[model samples]
Target: MDDLMKQLHAVLAVDKIDHNTVVKSVERNPYRRLLQEVLLERKDIIRSRMNLVALYETEEPSSEIEEILAQFENPTFPLEEINTEKEVEWQPLERKYLDGVSKIKEETTMKQTQLEKDLAKSLAHSEEVLKKHRDFRPVDDRDFSNVKQSITKHFEQAKTNLRGDAATKILVLRREIEQQGRKRRNFDKNTTDTLQNWFHDHRTNPYPSDQEKAELAKQCNIKISQVNNWFGNQRIRSKQQAIRMEEEEQKRLAALAAEESEAMQTALAAASTVATSSNLAAASLMTLPLVNPTMHAMVLPGMPQNLLAGTAGFLPQTNYFPTAGQMALADNGNGQPFYTDFENFGLATQPDSEQFNNYLG
Candidate 1:
């Protein structure tokens, strides 16, 4: 009996109404006709099942049997009469068989298991279908060649359902496309040359005038606001780069000054200690007093021979101590040191004296 029911169910399921098939009929609820057509097509099998169901409940021919016989004799039959008998016969029997608490629980558990299994299968099938769709790269060239065709495909479904308004939408979209295309082509042609010239001419200082920006807008067929914004961004970028370069120059000068100062301090300290010890050494040698001839040859023309000989001879005389100013001058190679001027003026004077004078003024 269960096998027979399964066979019957399969037959009923196979008699499907294609959900995608389009039918242009006046009636909107076309499923009524669809069900009738399926039933008519499988009339012989359905009639046999109805008879068996009736006989299983009661071992006799009922009013349902009489109705089934009448339907076969007359081709034109109402579904209402057949449905009425089937509902009355099946309702009591299903309720009576599945009434107990245990029976209800068993049936519910069985149904839930079946539903879970079906859901898992459906989810897997959906994932597989989605994977195929995701992997599929369209080989159809017409898909992208014309923009309007793609838009129409995406939006203009259900031709029968669409009223008069769709034509207006397509017309408006086309006009917008043409206007935008014209604006872009004009902008591209003029913008490149204008920007290149502006950047080149203003390499030293790149601030643009309002009049220049307006002229750019006219040439490019764009708004003045767009040119203004581009120049504003360029100015900010240029300023940041200038600031970075100035900072790097400052660090380099500071390092050079530090190295020079350390070397000068070391030389000054060594010269001071040598002068202090030479006085004691010269006093002890006074008992064997002698004049050196090489000392006379040290005096030469165009050289500070007197200053150098005096500094060397004075080191042996304990009574002769030069002033702090003279000591500083000696370390400075007998000329005003570059650092002294820097200390006074806070920077090295430039080599161009006229420019330095002008800057000072």
Candidate 2:
């Protein structure tokens, strides 16, 4: 017990030592210092219990003792020596743990930095896209609300009007619709006649210009569109009629050409027959005898009287006429007969001057 009190007194005296001196002492003998601290703590607990027992014996107010006991009941840890052999062994392990933790923290920080950079880039791209979209947007936005409002108001007015006068309004609407839907207009007789005459006059180029249409409409007391439609229908009908007429004319020309060809053929055949008959008569006249014994001799009007008196002796005698065999021999390859050996007759010789002069006379 005396040794324990001395250790407690030494522990208490440690508080009076300079901080540097105590740290040096603890460093020199850390295990011994830890043993002294633990012994001091035991001595304090023992002292506190002894005081409580004395207060219980006296039966005096034990509030202070109870407080002291309560304080002692709380658990307290002994001061550990920082430079002991066990703590020296755990130093390297603690340093390795700190190094691992620092390494992990650095990796997490690097990952966080990279993630921040990527997020920043994505935000910048998004901003650029939004800016481009804003630039491309239309300068003026169209508003259809006014048109919608007008249409709604019109429908409301129409409904109100319809509710007020249902039957008469319906009749008027029907009449208006009928008028609007009417495709063909009924023109007066005079207007129709005038239009027909104009169409006939300009049948080749039936299309009318805007000015002509306007004039016709004014004259007819109608709209220009009506005049245009009338002219359009008239042109189509006239073209169809013209095509039909042209086809008929072509057919008539073909028929006339055929009739002319037939007439030409008939005239050619008649001319050929007349030419053949004339040729046959010429052949028969050439075949006739120059002198006929049975026929009476007729004197020519221009013959001399002396030649006419000698004409009997100049004529061929009936016996001197060629026989059928001699005639056949005299015929050349041509149809005309040719006489040979005419020089055998002395009459073929040149006549004397007296005879020739008599024949000429």
Candidate 3:
């Protein structure tokens, strides 16, 4: 049964989709029909055993009742209704009947065990039949749900039995097929690229009109839902990326501005230090006495160099005499000195005798 389920699952995985066309009539797999009959016969056997169990409390064993009981007890029993497989896994019915207040429950328990064993054998046969003839079971009167409800009523823990296991596999396959049927189909790369081009062209208004979406769907070999889903995801992601880029740009600009500001501050600090030192030097010079080298060089020829150096600062600008180096009384290297009235070797207090005396010196 497990092996057969694997085979069926493989088939389902390959055929992910089923056509949606419906018909009033269609040929079903005869093997599945046979399995259905087997289930129905099992149901009837259950009804018969229940009646036989009730009848056992009053009457003795009858041939018909005994015949019905033999089918459940032995899988190899010859049957006139259908060809049964002789190769069946047979399990003996083991029970420890206690001194119970209700023997009917015990009787029912035995009946359930008998039914469970036979149902497993029937399922094993069905599995074999499925290996060759498994096809899509259309939704109809012969639905597995009816079989599930009928069989599960007989067992307290149906999930542990083979009937439950087969039914579970079938239902799961049906669900998978239905879900795959409703799933959104994928498009090729060209189709997605076309959609991307449209999205970019309409960046200011990416939301497509209904008619535009319909046109796109037709052009792209996709459905409207696929178009809508793609556009929605694309718009959100594009905005998110744009916002990230803007944030990164802002951060870059801020870092650059901070660097420029720091450099400017450093340059200003160095320039301010230089300016402060220059101002201090200028301030120290402001308190010193002044002197003129040109005035000292313009001393009278008779005056000593030391005397001129000492008194040149007190001499008025227009009243000065040549130094000894300019004198022609001895052999001077330069031409003869031209002593104007202001450059005479005399004091500015000259009047007559005293001035003449000063001039003579």
- Candidate No. with top lDDT: 3
Reference-based TM-score of each model:
0.25, 0.27, 0.29
Q: Which ten residues in a row have the lowest lDDT in candidate 1?
A: 338-347
Cα lDDT of candidate 2 equals: 0.44
lDDT of candidate 3 over 182-289, digit per residue (tens): 334577898989999999899999999999999999999888998999999999999999999999999999999677556544544543442333221222111212
lDDT of 2 by residue, 1-361 (tens): 3574455456435323234543344445436544455544434434433443443454333344333223123411111232244555455544543354344435544654665565455445434432332221211212123223333333333333323333233334334533433345488898888789888888777777888888889898888888987888888887899899999999999999677556544544542442333221223222222322111122112323333342232334233234443221223335654431212211333234364334324
lDDT of 1: 0.39
Span of ten consecutive residues with least summed lDDT in model 3: 90-99
Quality of model 3 by C-alpha lDDT: 0.45
Q: lDDT of all predictions, in order shown?
A: 0.39, 0.44, 0.45
Best by TM-score: 3
Number of residue pairs clashing in candidate 3, backbone atoms closer than 3 angstroms, sequence gap of 3 or more or interchain: 7
Instruction: Report the lDDT tens digits of candidate 1 across residue range 1-361.
Output: 3453344355445434222221212123335544344434345333434543443454333344344323223422122233455545445433432243234334444654665565455445433432332222221333222222322222222221121222233334334433433323333745867865796699787766889878878887778887877677767877899899999999999998677445434533442342333221222222212112222122111222332232223122122133332222122233432121211211122223343223223
Ranking by TM-score: 3, 2, 1
